[model samples]
Target: MKRLYFYTFFTIFLNFYANGQALPITEVFNYVIGTNLGGQGGWVNQNTGDEVLVQTGNLSYSGLLLSTGNSVSFAGGGIDPQLPFNAQSGNTVYASFIFRVTDLSTLTDPNGGYFAGFGQTATVFGGTVWLRTAGTQFNIGINKATSLTENTWLPTNFDTGTDIFVVIAYDLAIGEARIWINPAPGDLEAVSPPTPDGTANLNTTRSSLNRFFLRQDSATETPSIVFDELRIGTDWATVTPKDPTFSLEDKFKDRFVVFPNPATNGFVNITSGSQAPKDIHVYDVLGKLLIKQTISGSRLNIQNLKAGVYILKVAQDGRSETKKLVIR
Candidate 1:
C-alpha cells in the first residue's frame, strides 16, 4: 500500500510540473482596454504615479503569433508593473515582445533610459532594453546589468509609431547577453540562433532571473512607449514563434528572382517579372544596413562585402521582397 501511494504521489507531481512552470510564460494584456495593468495580469505595481494602463489595439508584425489583444502603454512617472515567473538558472533565457515608441519629444536626457528588462528583485535588473532620441528619430540599445548607461546602441535610428519585434537572450552560464531586432519570421531556434544586433558581457555577479519588469524612470529620460505580447521562455523558438498564416514563398512567387545565391565571385544578378528598375538593400545578419543603391541593370556589384550570410531586399513599384543571401 505504501509503494502504491508513493507511485500515485509521483504521478501527480509530474502532471503539475508539466502543466505549470515548464511551459513558456506569455502575456498579451488581454484585460479590458483603459484598465490599469497593475491590478490585472498578476502584475504588481512597484510605486505610485502615472499607472501603466491597458491601451487599445495590438502591435502586429508580418510573421509572428501572439499579436492578439490590447497592449499596455507607459507614458511617464513611477508606476512600474513587475510580473514574476519561475526562476531560471544555468542556461539561456529568452524574452521577446512587440515594442513601439509613441513620443520622444519630451525626452530630456541624452543617454536615454530603460523601459523593460529582466529582474531578480524590484530593483536589480539586467538584460534591459533602452531608447534614446536621435535627432527627429530614436535608437534602441541593450545593457547587461544595472549600468548607468546603455552598453551597446544600434547605429541605426528608427522612426516612431512603427511596430518592431525585439528578442533578448541572456546566457546565464556564460554571463553574456544578446539582442535581435526585426529578425526574419521564418527563422527558428531549432535550426540555429539568429545573429544578434548587439551583444554585451554581463557583470560578474550573476543572478537568477525570477521576474520581468516594465519600468518608468524619470520623465526626462524615458520615452512614451507601448509594449505588447511579452513572452519568456528557455529558447528563442519559444519566445519568437513564426505565424502560421504567412508564407514567404507565396508573397514573392514569380515576382522576383535572385541568382548566384552563394555568390562566389562577389557579384549577383537580380531579375523581376515587371522588369522595372530595382532599389536594393543588403543587410548583415545583425540587421545593419550595409549597402543601399538603385540599380537600373541586371547585375549588381558586391565585391566589398565579406563572405557571410546577408539579407537581400528588393523593392520595385510599390512592392518589396526579402530573401536570404550568402557570399562564399
Candidate 2:
C-alpha cells in the first residue's frame, strides 16, 4: 500500500524536507471540533447526533470538545473551565494543539496525568503530549527549554482519533527547548523508550504569558476528545490545513473583544462591532519574545507590564480575533 501511504507523509512532510527551512507555523486558532470559545469563551458538547444533544452558542463550557460524553474520565486534576490560550513570549516559542486521542490510559506522573499536560504551574509553561491504542506507531514532543527535571518520562505513541499533533519549540538564550509529535498518516504511535528525557524548564515567570490546558487534570475525563487548531507560534510547526473564510453554515461573522478578563489596572478594553483595522500583540511569561505591533482604534495600553498573562491579537476586516490578558 505504497508503504502504508509513505508512513502518512512521514509525520506530515517532516517540516518541509527536514530543516531546509519550515516551521514558521502560524494560524493561532481554529476551534472546529464543537465550537463555543469563539468569543464568550465556553464550549463542551460532543454527543454529535447519537442522542442527548444540546445547542446554544454551539455548547458553551470551556472550549476544545470535538465530542464530549463518550470518554468521560478527566476532572480531579482541575482545568475544566481552563481551555485558555492567546500567549506568546520572545526569543523562542512554539505551541501546537490538535487532539483526537479518545483514550490513552489516562497518563499521569511527575508531570501530571490524563496523557500528561502542564504549563501555568509546573517547571515553566507546560509539557507532555503522547498517546496510543493500536492504530500505528508515532513519537512526538515540544518543550525544549525549561526542564525542571522532575520524574521525566516523556513518551509518545498516539493514534486514538487521528489528527494528534503537539509541537513546541523554544531556544531563548540557549535555555533550550524542543518538542515534536508528528502522527497524522496511519498515525505513528510511539510508547516507552523516550522518557525522563524529552524537554522541560518552562517554569517560566520572567515576563508572564501562561495559559494552556488540554485533558485538564487527568484521571480520565476522557470526554472522547476531538480538538482542532490550537496554535501558538515562535515558529517550529507542522499541522498545515487551511481553507475557510466563512462557511461553517455562515452566521454573520465579525466578532472581537478584550475587556476585564481577569486583567487588572494597566489597559485591557478592546471591544469591537465594526470600525475594522484592529491588531495588537504583546507576549511575556517565559515563551518570552514580547511585542508584535500594529494597533488602530478601540483601546489598548497594558501599562509597562509586570504581573503576567498577555495575548490579544485582534484583526478586523481580515477577520481575526484572539483574547486573553491579565496583568496585576
Candidate 3:
C-alpha cells in the first residue's frame, strides 16, 4: 500500500507540473462589452486617466481560435493595465497579441511610445513594442528595455485601421529580444524559429520577468489602438498556434455546428457530421473548466451556467474543436 501511494502521488505531481507550465497565460479579453478592462480578467489598473474600455468585436488572424467576446481600446493619458504571471527565468519567453491603430493623427511625439511590453513590475518594462508615424503611414519597432528610441524598426510602413498580429520573444539567457509582425500562424513551428523582422539587445542585464502590461501614454505620444488575444508562453508555438481554418487534420472542421448560440432556453444543440458520442467541456474566459460531460445526442443542458460568454469544446474519436458560446 505504501509503494502504491507513492506512485500515485508521483504521477499526480508530474501531471500538475506539466499542465501548469504548458501555457503560462492566455487572455482573449472575453469580458462584458463596453466596460473598463482594469478590474476584469486578472488585470490591475496601475495609473489613472483614460480608461481602457472593452469594445464589441475582436481582432482575428487566419487559423487562430475564433476570437470571442470583446477587445480593449486606449488613446491617451497614463492609465494602463498590468497583469502578473509566474516569474519566468533563464529561458525564452514568448508573447503574441492582435492590435490595430484606429487613429494616429493626434500623435505628435517624434519618438513615439510603447503600447505593449513585458515588465518586471508595473513600472519596469522591456521587450517593448513601439509605434511612430512614417510620413502618412506608421512603422512598428521593438526595444529590449526602457529606451528613448526603438532599437529596430520594421522597414515597411503600415496603414491605419488594419489589424496586425505581433509576436515577441525575449531570451533571458542572452538578454536579447526579437519581434515578428503578421507572421503566419505556424511560422514558429518550423525546424528552427523563423527569422524575426526586428531584433534588439537588452542594454541592461535583467534576470526575470513577471508581468505584462498595456500602456496608454499622453495624447502626443500614443495613437488610438485596440488590443486582443494576448498570450504568453515559454515557446513560440505555445503563443502562436497555427490557424485552425487551415487545419486539415481537424475532422470536425466544417461539419460541426452549434445552434441557439445566445441560448435563451438554457440549452444548446450540437450537430456534427458524425453521430459518435462526444466529450464536452465548457470553459470561461479565464480558461476555467466550468462544465464537463459526455453526450450521445444533440442537446446539452446548460441551465446552471450564468449568463455570459463561454468556450465549448467538443471532442469525438480523439478529435476536438472549440467554439464560442454565449448565454443570454
- TM-score of candidate 3 versus the correct structure, residues matched by position: 0.67
- Residue 17 of model 3: what lDDT? 35
Cα lDDT tens digits, model 2, 239-326, are 2222233233222223455677666787677765566555456656454546554457766777777787865555443234345677
Q: Which stretches of candidate 2 lie over 4 Å from their true place?
A: 1-97, 100-111, 114-127, 130-167, 170-175, 178-224, 227-238, 244-268, 272-328
Residues 216-252 of candidate 3 have per-residue lDDT tens digits of 8888878999899899988877787765556654423
Better of 2 and 3 by lDDT: 3
- State the lDDT of candidate 1 residue by residue for 1-328, as single tens digits: 9999999999976654333344388899999888899857667789889889898899876667748888999866679898876778888889999888888877778888888888766788878888888888787788898685437986556667878788898888887878887765556334566678788784644567777889998888788888999999988888887767667673344356788989999799998755667778899997889998778887889999999999887755433457788999
Candidate 3 error regions (>4 Å): 1-23, 185-192, 247-328
RMSD of 2: 17.0
Score residue 101 of candidate 2 by CA lDDT. 46
User: Please, what is the TM-score per model?
Assistant: 0.74, 0.26, 0.67
Cα RMSD for predicted model 1: 7.3
Q: Which of 1 and 3 is ahead in TM-score? A: 1
Candidate with best TM-score: 1
